[model samples]
Target: VTITDDSEDDCQYEEVAADDEFSIQEGDEDLPKALQTIQEHAEDAQILASQSVLLSEKSVSEVPEAVDDFLCNFLVRLGMSRTLDCFQTEWYELIQRGVLSAKDTGLVPSVYTRNQELEMENMHLKKDLENYKLAANKAKEALLKMQKERDFHRMHHKRVVQEKSRLICDIKRLKTHYASYEPVLKHLTEKYQTTLRQKMLTNLERDRAVGQITGLQAALQNLESG
Candidate 1:
């Protein structure tokens, strides 16, 4: 059997032997059926080979078209002309430096190194986040302490104010009581002074009466002697 690749640039064919060429015993009753099976297998293999060739050709033809479409959509339509130019320059440089070869179909070492750097940066960010959380916790604790202190001071001030108000009310009540008693105190002082003056006048009048009585008795004695 001969298989040809018609779509290829250098079309070629490979010769494969058909299964009928296999030797069989002439007197065997299953020889025809066995030959028919072998022939069918050979036909199937040829069909498979032809289909594989067609698929290969199709894949090869579509590669450039796919690349073109990707470039148009990513660079031209998105207006990334500078990025496209830079990518082309980098590709050329990579080719010239032999960094990009047939065996290497992916990004170069720098891309991998950048990925490592990004991972390190992520780790640093995680550490910073933890530190920030710790600081926030401390700050929250301090805020709670301050609030308690404020509440204590506010209560202390309120108690002091209440005490001061009580003192003021007591002072005002004392003054009012003093004012109500002032008139009675003054009247008692005047009555005591009048009673003392009347007692002194009564003593002076009794002494005068005693002196007059003594003088009359002396006159009676002189008349009896004469």
Candidate 2:
């Protein structure tokens, strides 16, 4: 069982890894929590940088056929490894003492081998199930984050829409407010045009009067010269 368990040493278990983080958090109450979290992630990132990740692969080991091997496998499958080690010592001693017959260490039945294989398969399935659950949890976290972002954007969009509506209303009010000046502006423009026309007519009349006066002066000079 130990051999089979160590067959693929992909990643080591770090079950007590959070103890260090908890200790740091407890020891440094004055430190900002965000800084502490950043430090933790930095250390984790260093581990990832230093080691090459090995992908986990499923492996099925064939159970040994011997009686002792079967008992060892059984104890290991049942998680009684300490007892199995002690029993192995006793088992060899009894064999050396000749208290056990040859049939005792003979080949085990096919059913026990099949059962052990089934147990191994069941263990693999449990591990796979755990991996699936972990993936589901990460996906759930991502989905929740996305939903929060969606809601945040939706809120911003609503604010923008409200702001846009307010601007539209303000523009409409400004148009109506300024609309009141149109008639006054028209009246002023007409009055300016009328004043300009009157000024132009006075200039033309003044020029004609000056021309008539000059003609009369020229006629008087001609008569006096005659």
Candidate 3:
């Protein structure tokens, strides 16, 4: 049998017979019963397909009840009594624990809102972290500049101190040399004064001797003439 949807889509249904010894042959009394059973199975298949389409179109928040109903029917149909019981127990526990609540489910608007808020906060934190990293780099650069300036000043100060020490040593050496020559300079000055005075006295005594010799010569000439 074939079922066509509102959109004119044709869906074909193929029925498989269950593994049973009941075979309906032509002109058998069970032919009508077999036909009725096939029709019932075809109706059930059509209803199941429609339900599946509805479930697929429904949102997660609207799915729990539909899923529960579908599972109950499916388990009973399949004769999985024990599995059905276990599934019901687990489903009840989840519902009680609020795990299947509408608010906790991703179908709610609040979940999306909360996710947007978290994303905004994460963006802000990342921006702040970048700013902090830039500040740290600037601080490191400033520290390096200060260290270089300090090193330069320290080197300049050391050189100045060394030059000052050298000048002080030179001054002391010059003072010592002057001190050692002071007495010799003083003795030379006194000796020069004494030599000047002795030269003046010797010149005066030579002039007196020359004047006496001239007067005796004049007396001798006058006696010879008389």
**Which model is ahead, 2 or 3, in terms of lDDT?**
2
Write candidate 2's Cα lDDT for 23-100 as tens digits.
554466665785778687788867865564322222333333778887887787789989999999999999999999
On lDDT, the candidate that comes out on top is: 2
**Worst window of 10 by summed lDDT in candidate 3:** 1-10
Q: Compute the lDDT for candidate 2.
A: 0.81
C-alpha displacement of 138 in model 1, angstroms? 1.5
Displacement of the residue 203 alpha carbon in candidate 2, Å: 16
Residue-level error in angstroms, candidate 3, position 197:
1.3
- Residue 50, candidate 1: how far off, in angstroms? 60
lDDT of candidate model 3 versus the reference: 0.73
- 83-200, model 3: which lDDT tens digit per residue? 9999999988898988797443322234544564587688899999999999999999999999999999999999999999999999999999999999999999999899999988
Which number leads on TM-score? 2
Kindly list the per-residue Cα lDDT of model 1 for residues 1-226, writing each as its tens digit.
Answer: 1122433655467776653445454676796787896787778878988998998776564332222234434476458989888877876688789987654433234444456458668889999999999999999999999999999999999999999999999999999999999999999988888878887887788788778878877888888887
Candidate 3 versus the native: TM-score? 0.49
Q: After superposition, how far is residue 7 of candidate 3 from its true place, in Å?
A: 37
